[model samples]
Target: MSATATTTVTATDSPRKGRSGARPLHLPGGISLRVERRALAVGVLLTAAALALAVVLIGTGDFPIAPWDVVQTLLGNGTPANDFIVNDLRLPRVLVALLVGAALGMAGGVFQSVSRNPLGSPDLLGFGYGSAVGALVVIILFKGGATEVAVGALAGGLLAGVAVYLLAYKQGIQGYRLVLVGIGASAILIAVIQYLITKAQMIEATRAMVWLTGSLAGRDWAQVWPLLAVCAVLFPLVLGQGRALRMMEMGDDAAHAVGVRVERTRMLLMLAAILLTTAASAAAGPISFVALAAPQLARRLTRSPGGNLLTGALMGSVLLMVSDLASQRAFGADQLPVGVVTGLVGGIYLLWLLVTERRAGRI
Candidate 1:
């Protein structure tokens, strides 16, 4: 009977022999990746879709350029009017949306995978509020410039993450404890933001409110370069830890038994997530729920287990671009902030998540 059970388990674990041949690519430090053809196909399709949507957005704005003109302008060939509209006016906003969305999505994926909870995103876990508080201080009290606001946001997010980690650390960190602490920290930070807004002068208050709502209205290369630099440095670091993160989902003991340094890996991933969230928030003022919803959305689209970082990043880019387009075109001439649209949509997604989790007995 034992032998029969062993045989059954082995057969179940083995990959099918004939369907889509498996390609095993070995890496340094004994890491390996199983490349699936179907996954590759899905990735290509998603990328194409995202690019198509971006083109549509660039060509459909107020000073609308033709799609052909947009493509030519992107390639440095269109007439000056087309060039001005696509290259100068529309392109930067689209780029910022893509980069920020990707950063937030990747951050969400890391946090969710590390905590082994769907509610473990930066927005839900307090990092976004923390960054917002930092930026608010610069905007209201100091009347600082854009660079200063970005730096303050980064500092605030890092500080918030450390505080929550220390407070949640008991014998060891647990998902539920970290989440609870983060939510509390987030609330406190939000209250601080509200107070600061109230004390500012009318003009400053209006600016603060718009920034808090996460607009990409006048975003230019100034916003784009900083976020691009941060994502370039941090995304690779996060992707490298994907294997260890997957191991961690099986519990610390199991991960440790598999030669993973559980605590160290979690700390590193958490730091990366915080930095990603900070950079994105600094650029776009906590664009609500891209971090919260992007990873799970990607997971469903790919039907893959674990983080699905690449797909998550793509989905985030698509979601933000679509939202920005909707905000500009949906309500006639009174252009809304991208954050407003996301906030409305994300609120619904949050409610549905809660209901679903409750039904599954995981809430």
Candidate 2:
């Protein structure tokens, strides 16, 4: 091989941990574990920031409780009134917001990695629109409640992912092809959603529109518990596949040459991402831009290339919570949907991203 070709091959074959500046720790039986310090540091800092924000968010509003009281109430130690407001009233909403953000962020990491595209996300891949279609069908046609709507959204997202996969599967699912097919599916599903909206009764249409905008208002333990359960199962599943995902970013042929089971890894990651997207959508109504922006933001924060699932998830949680706070207080008692805040911010971020990518000749 030519010198340059040989050099490229060597770099592509290098251990990813080394590229990330990961450190090794000695262990029993002559074993060792590698940890990426930057990702770890970023994760810890984001966790602290997210928790602090959560506490402050929980403490705000009429009949305000102190941060300490919010903490205590969360720990099951607060008095009845504080508990009523914190636990019964607010905690679930905040928790849902955090979980929804985390789920979407991690899912974004998965999709972006699989597609090798910065714009690859549930928001653009038709899953969100599919969830919306399912949800609108339930809300407008069947007159379903929150729980039913969540179930429908989940079903819709999964079906959308499958359809996108099937359409993109020609010649074994190329990265760009998957993204293009997914975006096309999203556009079509959006039209379906609009049609459903036109068919709804006035009251149902109002509620459906609000749900479409994605609010945390009236969220309770019901939303929290199911979403938490999904996150518990899916977070580790997706993170376990992160290394293989980063490998796939090197290209499928190279990854397959390394015994990475490229197609299997891609399929598993896609399924996991789809489920996470649906779960977040089910919980929070496909709150915009968190899926699109969180992973990218987390990677930049860590000074990493991309696909740090944990950091991305933490960053996602933080973004959603911050947006939730802004939505509640940014206006004077208007109490907008959390989706509105994220949508506005995400829109601006999207424009900046496009311009930045254009400058870099990547768009």
User: Which is the leading candidate under TM-score?
Assistant: 2
Worst 10-residue stretch by lDDT in candidate 1? Answer: 1-10
lDDT of 2 by residue, 1-363 (tens): 000011110112246757666666567777544556676678789999899989988998877889998889999999999989998888888899889999998898889878888889888889999999999999999999888999999999999999999999976778799889988998899899889889889999998899899889889999999999999998777766665666677888877886788888789889989999999999889799998898899878766654877788888999999998898788977888999999999999999999999999987
Best by lDDT: 2
Candidate 2 regions with alpha-carbon error over 4 angstroms: 1-21, 26-31
**Local distance difference test, each candidate:** 0.81, 0.83
Clashing residue pairs in all predictions, respectively, total 0, 0
Error of 2 at 290 (Å): 0.5
Q: Report how far residue 158 has shifted in candidate 1, in Å.
A: 1.6
Clashes of 2: 0
